[model samples]
Target: MKNILVLCTGNSCRSQMAHGYLNTFSQGKAKIYSAGIETHGLNPGAVSIMKEDHIDISNHTSNHVDEYENIDFDYIITVCDHANENCPYIPSKNAVRLHHNFFDPSKVVGSDSEIHNAFLKARNEIRSYFQAFVNEKL
Candidate 1:
């Protein structure tokens, strides 16, 4: 199976959402992993929002990129600008790197509806992007 890594500033929201969508889109044809420059812990909003879309990421953990230093990844994807800009070197000889800055729902400070909308928007964008990634690249 092809191995993919989704990286972000934190292992909390955008990366986690992308991980979920990528896993679904790849349909067992790929192995998916996600990590952060710093572990911010899995965001609750991410879990809830994913659940709304019938994906479960509540069991996912916030991980540091250093934890996967030994695995040779096929593709390394950064889901946010911060992670893309500041990402540490990963020693994957042939890994194809990709970057897309998904909106951070956790940063949307407002009423409940606004927060929910933010998460939903990010989730939808992630789904669309990864589906295309799987179709084109995986």
Candidate 2:
């Protein structure tokens, strides 16, 4: 199976979402992992939004990129600008690095509905992106 890594500034949200989608879309063809430059813990908003789409990320944990240094990855995808620009080098012999700056819903400040919508928006965008990534690459 191909090994894939989804990375972000915080493993709490965007990377977690992409990890979930990649697992679902890739079926058993790939192993999906996610980590952050720094662990911020899993975002509850991300869990709730993903659950709405029938993907459960509630069991996912925030992880630091250092945790997976021993594995040879086929792909390394960064889901936020900060992580992409500042990510430490990983010694994957042939890992294809990809990046997308997804909007952070946790940073949005607004009414309940607005905040939820923000999560929904991010979730949808993440879903679309990773689904295509799996289809095209896996």
Note the Cα lDDT for every prediction shown. Answer: 0.94, 0.94
TM-score per model over all chains: 0.98, 0.98
User: Which consecutive 10 residues in model 2 have the weakest lDDT in total?
Assistant: 129-138
Q: Candidate 1 — which pairs collide?
A: none
Tens-digit lDDT track of model 2 for 1-138: 999999999899999999989989998999999999999999999999999999999999999999999999999999999999999999999999999999999999999999999999999999999888878887
Put down candidate 1 lDDT per residue, 10-97, tens digits, no spaces. Answer: 8999999999988888999999999999999999999999999899999999999999999999999999999999999999999999
Model 1 misplaced regions, further than 4 Å: none
Clashes (N, CA, C under 3 Å) per candidate? 0, 0
As a whole number from 0 to 100, the lDDT of residue 63 in candidate 2 is 97
